[model samples]
Each structure stands twice: as C-alpha cells, then as structure tokens.
Target: MRKAMIVWGGWPGHDPDLCASMIRGWLKAEGFEVRIETTTAAFADPAIFDLSLIIPIYTMSKIEKAEALNLCAAVSSGVGLAGHHGGMCDAFRDSVDYQFLCGGQWVAHPGNIIDYRVDLTRPDDPIMKGLKSFEHRSEQYYMHVDPANEVLATTTFTGEHAPWIEGVVMPVVWKKRYGTGRVFYSSLGHRAYELDVPEIRTLMTRGMLWAARE
Candidate 1:
C-alpha cells in the first residue's frame, strides 16, 4: 500500500489538529497507510524517505535546519508533498528551503473570511477535471507563488478588499516539481469545516493523489 504522513501542529487558529484528522480519514479512504506526527522532528526521521507522500499541516511554525533539509531532500528525491491554505504555505517562515519546496508562500488574506470565486484555469488537468468554477466564502489568499508552477486554478481580486491588487488574478491551485518530486498546493481551506465544500474536498484529495509518487 502507498504510505503517507501528516505532520501537523502550529497555530491553534487554523485548527491544525482537527484538519489533520480530517485529512487522515480522507487518505485512509483512498487506501493509503497513513501516519500522523505532531512535531517537526518527524521530518528528520530517515524513515520518511520510504513514504510516498508527506502532507504538512503546520502553520507559522519553525523547523530546525536539519529537519527542514531532510524534508526538502526527501521531496527532492521523489516523495510527493501536498497541502492547502496557511497549513502549507504559511509554514516555517524562517526556512527558505522549505518555502522553495512548497513553491509558494501565503502573504495576506485581504478581507479575511469573505466571499470569493474560484475559477478552474486548467479544467482539463487531471487534478481539476470535472470541476467547475464555484462560489466560495473564505479567506481569499494572496500568495507569492513560483512562476514555474503549472497553475490549475485561479481567483481574481476585486479592489474592494485590497485596492492595489484589484483585478489581479492569483493562483488558487498549482502543481510544481522539486527535483523529481511532485508538489501540489491549494489556497483554499481556512478552517477544517471548509472541507465540507465539495469542490475544495475534491480538489484537495485529487491533488494529493496527483502528487503522490507513482
């Protein structure tokens, strides 16, 4: 069976523990042998090299240099990495290497918890296939993303929230590569209950499968 690990814990505001439990159930339903860890030390364990995927649910936390290096090296060596919202993008602000592996960093959510729309930019992509643009009510993430990311979905910012970025189209979902590894991320899911949104749940689970090592 394919193996996956979820290392969760950081800000209580994001409910990392609750979110991790939800994702663990999703992975189990998909036939993965899932493991859960509560600290960054799990990242440095050499055993991580044997896993097929790593999902980091940590937001605004610190990672030791060694732990960060091991985690990045594992992904670079072909293990997949996938995550959503601040759990992934807002993690380890001090670790540039970790940020590099993630392909993007969360900067701001202009009008926190507001209504927005997510548009599928590459609807033909397997991760996005069968999905349509949908109305969403959550934090609309404005991120600093890698230009090389194969963007699959996007959202447009209206000046009402942040006037300077009005009309700016931001990547809502994207996939990229770190060495031979697949990296996938979505700017959705601010809270655990947001997964109740079918589109968010579908894309997140599909993206995990897409990022997994074959």
Candidate 2:
C-alpha cells in the first residue's frame, strides 16, 4: 500500500491537529497507509524520511536541524510536500532554510476575514479541472509570492482599503517544482471550517495526490 506520514502539532490557532485529522481521513479513504507522529523528534530521523510524502503543519518553531535537513533532502530527492496557509508559509518565519523549501513567506493580508473571491487560473491543472470560481468569507491572504511558483488561483483587492494594493494579484493556490520534489500550497485554511468547504476539500485532495511523488 502507498504509505504516508504527517507530522503535525503546534499553534492551535491554526488548528493543525484538526486539519491533520481531516487530511488523514481523506488519505485513508484513498488507500494509503497513513500515520501521524505529533512529536518534534519525528522530524529529525532519517528512517522516517522515506515516506511518499512529508507534511509539516507546525508554525514558527525550530525543528531539530537534523530533521529539517532530512526533510529538505527528501523533498530535493523527489518526495512531495503539501500544506496550506500558515501550516507551510507561516511555519518557520525566521528560518531562511524553511522559507527556501516552502518557496515563499506570508507577508501582509489586507482583509484578515472579509468576503473574498478565489479565481481559478490553471483550468487545465488536475486540481482545478472541475472547479469554477469560488467565494468564501475568510482571511484573504496577500502574499509576497515566489515568482517561481505557478499560481493556480488568485484574488484581487477589491475592498475599499485595498485600492493602493489593487492590480497586485495575490496567489490563493499554487504548485511548484522543488528540485525533483513537487510542492503544493494554498493560501486558504485560516480555520477548520475553511478546510471543510467542499471546494477547498476537492482542491486539496487532488493536490495531495498530485504531490505524492507519483
């Protein structure tokens, strides 16, 4: 069976545990041998680094250097990495190594929790194949994105407080190639309910499958 391990915990504000459980259930239904290791020690062992994918949902903490290096090597060797919002972008704000691996950092979000629209850009992408434009009432992330990342979804600043920021499109969802490893990240998921959204769930499912070193 396909095997995967997710290391999650930290910053309950992001609800990492709850989000991890949801992703676990989806992967389980998809026939993967899923495991959860909610400990910092797990991130450092080389033995645990050979899974089809490695998911880190922690935010703003230093993982053991050994473990962090192992994960970086795994991704460079073609293991896929996937996460959303702070789980990936806000994870290690001070660690350039972490930012390099994640492709970008979360900068400023104008409307933290305002009505926003996520426009599907990569219509041909498998993750967006059946998706139409989606709308949600949540924090619309405005990231200083990596030019290397291929954006799949985006939102424009149409709010009154965003005029100056207008025309500066923000990426809502993106996919990129890191060395031999594939990476996927979405600016959604500020809350558990965001993950519960059918559109978000669908996007994440396809993204996970695509990023799993297939």
Candidate 3:
C-alpha cells in the first residue's frame, strides 16, 4: 500500500481536523496507509521522505527552519504534495520555500463568502477529466501564483466586489512540479461542507491521487 501523511493544524477557521478526516477517508479508500498528525514537527521526520504523498492542511502558521527544510527536501526527492485553500497556500506565511513548492499563496478573497463560478480550463487532463464548470458560494481566492503552474481551472472576477480586478481571470486549480515531485492545489473548500459538492470532491480526490504519483 502507498504511504501518505496528512499534517493538519493552524487556523481553526478552516476546520483542519474535519478536512483531514475527509482526506483520510479518501486516501484509505484508495488503498493508502494514511497517517494524520496535528503538528508541523511531523514534517521533520526523516521517514517523511519515504511517503508517497504529503497533505498539509495548515493555514497561517509557523514552521520551524528544520521542519521546513526537511519538508522541502522530501518533496524535491519526489514525494508528492497536495492541498487546498488557505490551509496549504496561506500556510507558513513567512516561508518562501514552502510557497515556492506550493506554486501559489493566498493573497486576498474578494467578497469573502459569495457565489462564484469555477470554470474548467483543462478538461482533458486526467485530474480534471469529466469535470465541468461549477458554481460555488464561498471565498473567491485571489492568489499570487507561479507562472510555471499548469493551470487546470480558473475563475473570473465580476468587479462587483473588487472593481480593479473586474474581468480578471485567476487560476483556481493548478498542478506543478517541485523537483521530481508532483504538486497539486485548488483554491476551493473554505468550508468543510464544500467538499460535499460532487464536482469539488471529485476534483480534490483525483488531484491528490495524481500527486501521489499513482
């Protein structure tokens, strides 16, 4: 069985525990030997490098130097990493290395919790195959993303909330490589219940499986 670790804990607003539980169920159902840890210290373990995938659901938290370095090294060595929303993108705000690995960082969410559309950009990609544009009533993330990312889905700003960004298209889902490792992220799921949306749930699950190098 493939080995995977989900290290969660940071802001309680994202409901890290609930997110981890949902992911745990998915990973186990897919035949992975999954472990869940509530601390960033788990990233420092040498064994982390041996895992198939790492999911960090930590938002706006601090990561020690050693732990950050170890986590980066593991992903660089081809251990896949996958996550979503502020938990992954906004995590370790001071750690540029982590942000570099993630390919993006959450900067702002215009209109906070409101309805928006997530348009599929690469429907042919396996991770996005069979998925269609969907409507979501949540935070519309405006991120500073790495140009190198292979964007798979996007959202356009209507300017209703933020005038300057009106009509601007922003990436909502993307995948990239950090060294030989696969990295996948989505700017969705501000609330745990959002994962219940069929399309959102399917996309996240498929993205994690893809990042696992499966």
Quote each prediction's TM-score.
Answer: 0.98, 0.94, 0.98
lDDT of 3 by residue, 1-214 (tens): 8999999999999989999999999999999999999999999999998899999999999999889999999999999999999999999999998999999999999889989999999999999998899888999999999999999999999999889999999999999999999999999999898887899899999999999955
Query: When superposed on Cα atoms, how far off is each prediction in RMSD?
Result: 0.7, 1.5, 0.7
- Candidate 2, 1-214: lDDT as tens digits: 7777788877888889988898999989988888798876776677654677777788666676666677788888888888888888888676676677877788777756789888999988989998899888887777767899989999888856677887767888998888899888887888877898988999988888888875
Worst 10 residues of 2 by lDDT: 40-49
How do the residues 64-83 of candidate 1 rate in per-residue lDDT, one tens digit apiece? 99999999999999999999
Summed backbone clashes in each candidate are 0, 2, 0
* Residue 66 Cα positional deviation in candidate 3, in Å, after optimal superposition: 1.5
Error of 1 at 205 (Å): 0.7
Off by over 4 Å in 2: none
Give the Cα lDDT of each candidate. 0.94, 0.82, 0.94
Q: Compute the lDDT for candidate 1.
A: 0.94
Number of the candidate with higher lDDT, 1 or 2: 1
Window of ten residues with lowest summed lDDT in model 3: 205-214
